[model samples]
Target chain A: MSLRQILLVLKREYITRIRSKAFILATLLIPLGMVVFFGIVVGISLWDSDTEQTIGIADRTEVLYPRLQEIASERYQNLSDLAEDSLQALVQGEEIDGFIVLEETHIEGQKDPEYISSGSGGLKLQNTLRTDLREVIRNERLARADVSEDVQKIYESDITLTTTKLTESGEETEDDTGFLTIVGFIMGAIIFGAISGYGGLITRSVIEEKTNRIIEVIASSVKPIELLFGKLAGIGALALTQMTFWIASLLGFAAAAGPLAGIFLSEQMSNMPETAQTAQAPQGIDPEMFSIPAIETSLIIYFAIFFILGYLIYASIFAAIGSAVDSEADTQQYVLPVMVPIFVAYIIMFQTMNNPDGTLSVIGSLIPFCTPIVMITRIAITDVPFWQISLSILLMIGTFLGTMWLSAKIYSVGILSYGKSTNWKELMKWVRQG
Target chain B: MAVIEVKNISKSFGDTRAVDNVSFEIPKGRIFGLLGPNGAGKTTAIRIINHILIADSGTVTINGYPVSSKTQSMIGYMPEERGLYKKMRVGEQLIYLAQLKGLSYEESKKKIRYWLDRFEAAAWFDKKVGELSKGMSQKIQFIATIAHNPDIYIFDEPFSGLDPINSEMLKEIVIELRDNGNTILFSTHRMEQVEQMCDDICLFNNGKAVLNGKLREIKQRYGKNTINIEFEGDDAFLDELQDVRINNRSANYAEIRVLNGQSMQEILKKAMNHAEIYKFERVEPSLTEIFISTVGEDNINPKELS
Candidate 1:
């Protein structure tokens, strides 16, 4: 109950953990790791549309080939010297990626055209022919019907889909569901990793104290509950430190990723062979797409609140598990049960992220153990109701207080009892005794 | 006035009563020995007094206040299962423990430096506890216990891991601490330690204090009926000694108990005809014999107790 004693223990636990090689490595290496992983993903996205090849066409209906050739993806070739059977030979010989045969029946628009491919990563070639062939066939048919050239041009224009979110006050704001889903998934993953990862740290430290027989000396100096709080607070501080490093570096990466990945892509493009360059590079992906969307300040505040409450609830339970066992290996049976809720939260998070207001998502976000992750995802994805947020926070705090008392009881008794393999019945007895 | 008192303290773990109605007091500035064999509830009693475990129905007082956080700061306790923080530096670990016991940062550092110097472990100030040898860590553990300079000291088996030279040094330091008006209480089943150092003693067996009194008064009450002889030729005369029990026999000496009005002079007169009598002295019973006689034969198993 004494603040001074608690602080002393806190100081010891903090200093020792901070100075360890593991903490230093994790703090430094994880950010470095994220940068590498992000760079690789960006590289793959950039390279996906950049494949280059020549497409050959055999037009049996003489008039269609010339007009099709006019819409210049200049990588398309007219196979004028080829016999009908030899067009397949050209594609198979690697002289062309694939060949499309346009017949009088395709021009009549009665049937789908045939495009044969060697199928060696030629799916993009088939998709391009499909779109262009349909456009060419539709224009030919329209011209046969005596439609004007200006009307044909108007029919070929592309259409795009956009969404606008309408507020209760009759204002509208542009919303992208893809962007929101990314935000929700990212926040949910970070929360899950932190709680599951740091809870083990609390358990390990308690086991260290018990195995070394230093628990007796400490138990005499301070109350067991004081020791438990100090331990949780100290290690909780370390977890926060690590989490902050990850958040800052990762968010910084998100902000700067456009330019960084752009530099990586250009360097990669310049390294290609001369023949590949002559074959032509396709239009590039927008570099802006690589950057993460801006996050709201209120969401960060909710995340902070939930992350801390969630950590304390789980960390105290881990501490109790630590006190109950003599070795880390003995913690396996207990850790599995604790991990079940986290995995459940993880599995339910995707459903919650997509439909933030659905019944399943609503229930998932309200459960105390799942609230920290699922509720944060909901906030990231859309505007959550004030009552739901408040109730979730209340439930989280209430669960933490309840778990704190239960864990303190088990920890106090278990730390002092040594050299016995404690079972569930024995642990129940300890809880009652405390 | 007694410095520490435990009144009617009883604790039970499951069906086993670890400490049963144990009542004892440690007088100010005196060495009190808590003597008991293994599993005899000595640790449970020490833990209750230290407030590590609260007794089910009893009161423990330090100075005049009941045992609470206030009194907790007034006592130093080194448990039998004591260990240092193995991964931490010697000085840093000591300072942390001292601060927990209510010393300031500056005061903890100062006391730590003084104790490490006194123990000749100043060079190891920055050395990790895991790097130290067993005896070396025992020295560090001792320093940690006393660095705060509390009014009362309780050390359980403080000499268990030390070499003879270090053990002798520790005995001297304990005596010095007592001389400086700090009450000391230590538990040991080793009777020789109690015989050599204790001003008072309490013997426990099966969760009950079997015998309790000043060590001098207890010895006098047992009466001086044993003779210790140091001689050169003790080949066969020891077996022939009449009306006496022989113990602690060796090539040069033997301890003999006189019983049934047997005379020491008659034994000495008989011994002169056989061997050279270098010295003869009558002494109080050894603590081992007293413990056996006090606890009764059925309860005392010398092999296991020792």
Candidate 2:
């Protein structure tokens, strides 16, 4: 292969895309869009915070109303004195957002009385109401039983879990299972996005040169294999540039708004089921239990290795697919089969986060197409054995070489050909000819 | 010395034979025409010579070396279907193509500027190819083909889309290239264009080179054997002519072939008595007549040519 020709082709590919209007717009606008989106969300919540829900509580039990009023007087009012008809009129006329009538059965019996309303306030208002009423009832019952006020106060306090991993070296490190899952998923998602997004870029590039008939002039100048490598490397470099830009910008933003960034991240991690509720500090537990685990230098190295191999393997497949067809719409059959593995690997990533060393995760990490995402994630969340990591890396190297060779072959012949319906059989024919 | 030599080269696409057992030689500093009708394998042969397609059998050598990237670097090739990256600026695109052909970055930039200035396309340097008109882009494609300053230039149907003014201008530059000792090979079905430019001509029909020789020698072999008759009368020509083939018949014009064997006086006198004759002369066979008649005859009897 002529490295010079490849470099020249690569240079052209890189410069044009870096200067493209789409790249510049996306680079500048995506972060701005995110800021605006989050601002709207935060703004709506802050506005909602000011509008308090006034619930007129018609307490049948004279004992509970006084205790409820003594607690949250702002959200609850005594509707107990009003007639039922008048209470209904108050809710409909918007005098009160909603009202709850406490019947004698509710105070003495086991039932939750419905809060009749015009459906103005949602679940959050109801959730807070439940917590307030429960606290009032619990306090009254405990007080009547002659329990100490200190015991009641201690009962409602936080209890958090602290997990420390005992490494083979006998070093105690914070077990960052949940936090590490987020890191792995973020990196994996970047890989997945690069493959699909930059893969389309490569495909569209191939189609552009082919359909425009520029391939003929290029073929005469350089070998098709050179063109193939040049294109992959060029676009791959561009993808890395875009990814790094986004990540650096994200880090800067996080540093500038440290506390808010923490809240946003924890909010994202809410679904991961962290042991401690971050909104409140634990009474006596170590705060490090909620700390984000440091992404180690070795883990970053593994990420780089898997990410590069994964990008090459999938990018070559995309290039081959692009060469085989004359237009983007004609790429359906080839694109679908290639996407299935990535989609499957992504679905299994969530499962891997929860159970990193599960059989499915191990098997997925061994398979060529799914390996990069699953293995990196598994390594992040838990300790993956040396042999498995080694085997995974070796398998990835083999797949990348094979994919590069195969795609080059298909690409060389397919670009010169035009206006034939390309199928699996036709593709194979091209491979043989190539 | 021969700049290019193809010996018994043949290529096939599945069941279809695109080029079959074709061979020719192009000496340095000469203009050669690869002449053929549509679908006659000229493009396939041109591609094979450029190493864009490898022949199924036989050899193609450029300057005594087998066609490879090294030799490809010495050749500037423009394919029949001209195209450039629509989104790329003219200057950068030319530099990119030049670099691909093994020119260094500095050399490419220098040459690109010179060629753009030469073509009067310096203003188009910053313009994307998509913004240029068809004829203007054709100039850009030409500049790209030649800017690298390779040893040999191959242009397929280079004169097809050009207007007469630009066509004449391109012809002047081509002749200049020839005078500077660069081998030029271009293919065209337009015999008229090749007539003024080619030192030698190879005529292709159905993937076979049926005629190959020096341009003058090929025309000379057919001899001065046609009478051009342009008349203004509707009166029918007397049907007393014999042993002479008539062609290019029209209401006011006809090419009567005396064709070296027949006497022209009888046919001239016959036309003279029948209608008002404006012009008549014994003319040597034009390349168009020779090509048509030769191809027509080749189609029927299929003579072996070397």
Candidate 3:
């Protein structure tokens, strides 16, 4: 129980892991890999923009030629006035994405206009040109009919809607679009999942040591609690260091190449014109309003606390199971029940993303078993009650402590057992025997 | 002074009694052998001593106190099954284990370095336990077991994977530890090793100590009636000897096993009358022979013993 003994184990474990090539490689490569993967995707999408298609346009009216040329040059290369036979050949050829034919005839109130396009390729391009030409003809006819251009300009203006929320304090606030919150929920979910995944790795390590009988030698020198805490602290330190490295590398990459990503996004935004400001507000989510959702801190603390306690709880159980059995293959029977809570937490986290205040999310967050992950996601999207957060933390702590107490009992009994299959029933008996 | 005392300890696995009323005392400054074949509850008893497993009944005392944390700190146990983290560096692992046994880091470092050097494993300081050969790993393990200078040492089959040279090396270390006033428990199936190293032993059979006593005393009690008479004895002089079983006879010498009550002096006198005697001396039974005779004739279930 001595801190010195615990630190000795912790120091040994940390040094070994920090020096391991797998750990070092994983720490550096994960962030780099993510950056490279995203970079390549963005690069390919941007590169696709450079290769413009050659389209043929046949204008029989010549009156529609000006508008056609303007739209064609704006979107693609225009090869106007090709012979009918050449147009047919180009439409059927691989050199162009498509061809368009425009025809017009002067009439009293009905000038029948026909637009022909290739059956395959550049449908949006052809559609854009056709719409522009129709607008040009409409305007020309409107002037002929003595209608003013000012009224037409007013008719063509765009409108947008804004949403507001009535708060509990009788104050009005811009209803933060669920988009950033959704993204936040996703981020929290991912972080939770990633941490749990690695924390599960720590559990496996505990089981491995117990199953391999190395814990016997280790426990001989240090107390079981010391060994348990040392491993958690050691692996926790490693995980934290790697997480810091990953985050720093990501920030560094963003710092170095952020403008490039911004430029590409802005260009894409200009082309669409609709979603231009959507990506902006999200990028600029006010730090004051977007102060890491209180739930994140709670989640991080809860996750840290629960991760160690939960891992110790589960890992202690796992270690006991490992000691009772002869090999890792036999560990699955015990692990399945342990993994159920993690799986439940994952499901609750995902479902609560869209409806953080919903009954299911609220209940899930309160459930001691699901709160570690579910509450974190809930905290990201909506303001969780202080009471609820405190309660969940307390419950999680209690569960962790109870599990650890229960599992340590089994571990002390089971570590020397071998060459036998150990199930829950036998484990219960062993616990009872104690 | 006794270093360890086990009084009427019993342990069971399910319905099978692994150790039934097992009791033995390990005196300080001697190699006390725990002799039994595989599955004879020798390992189970050792585990109880190390506090790795609890006994179902009875008590164990070490150094005038009940075996507890304090006793554990003074004890070093090398389990029959090797228990070392394979991925840990040899030197770091030894120091860590030593520190756990209550050595200061500085002391552990110095002791570990010295022991590793003695075992010729100084080069293995940076190498992981997994990277060492079985024998080398065993040496590192032995170093770890003894690095903290525990007053009581327990080694179970420590020579299993060691070659003759390393085996001899370990035996020397065991002897040295004893000479330094450390109580040592040596458990093995090798009777020759027991004969060479142990001052006292308890041979277990069917979860019970079938034979227990000082080694020299046990050998003496098995009798020294075997006389090797190297002489030109008349053929009729052999017949005159009472209750004598001939062990071997040469052209110039004869060896005979006489009954317990029969005197060797009479046989010497009887042989002298018939021929000139060159040599006549009683021979004692080896530990190996005694062990086989004691357990072999006990009518215990061999399956359970194994």
Number of the predicted model whose lDDT against the real structure is largest: 1
Quality class of the docking in candidate 2, CAPRI style: medium
Instruction: Tell me the deviation in Å of residue A272 in model 1.
Output: 24
Point to the candidate with the largest TM-score.
2
What shift in Å separates residue A241 of candidate 1 from its native position after superposition? 3.0
Residue-by-residue lDDT tens digits, candidate 2, A1-434:
88888888888899999999999998899778868998999999999898888889888877788888788788789889998889999988999988888765665447777778999477788788888777777766676678777897886688999988898899988786777888888777777777788888888999999888899999999888889989999988887788779877876665556555556665656655456555454333343444444578898788778878899999999999989998999999899999999999998888898898999999999998998888888888888999999998899899999998899888988888876647898789878877
* Better-scoring candidate (TM-score), 2 or 3: 2
What interface RMSD does every candidate have?
0.8, 0.7, 1.8
lDDT per residue as tens, model 1, A189-217: 88898888888888888898888999998
Q: What is the lDDT of candidate 1?
A: 0.85
Candidate 3: docking tier: acceptable
RMSD of each: 6.6, 6.5, 8.3
What TM-scores does chain A show, candidate by candidate in order? 0.79, 0.80, 0.63
TM-score of chain B of each: 0.91, 0.92, 0.79
TM-score winner between 1 and 3, please give it: 1
lDDT (C-alpha) at residue A155 in model 3:
55
Candidate 3 off by > 4 Å: A40-183, A207-213, A248-330, A418-426, B224-306
Candidates 1 and 3, the one with greater DockQ: 1
The TM-scores of all predictions, comma-separated, are 0.82, 0.84, 0.74
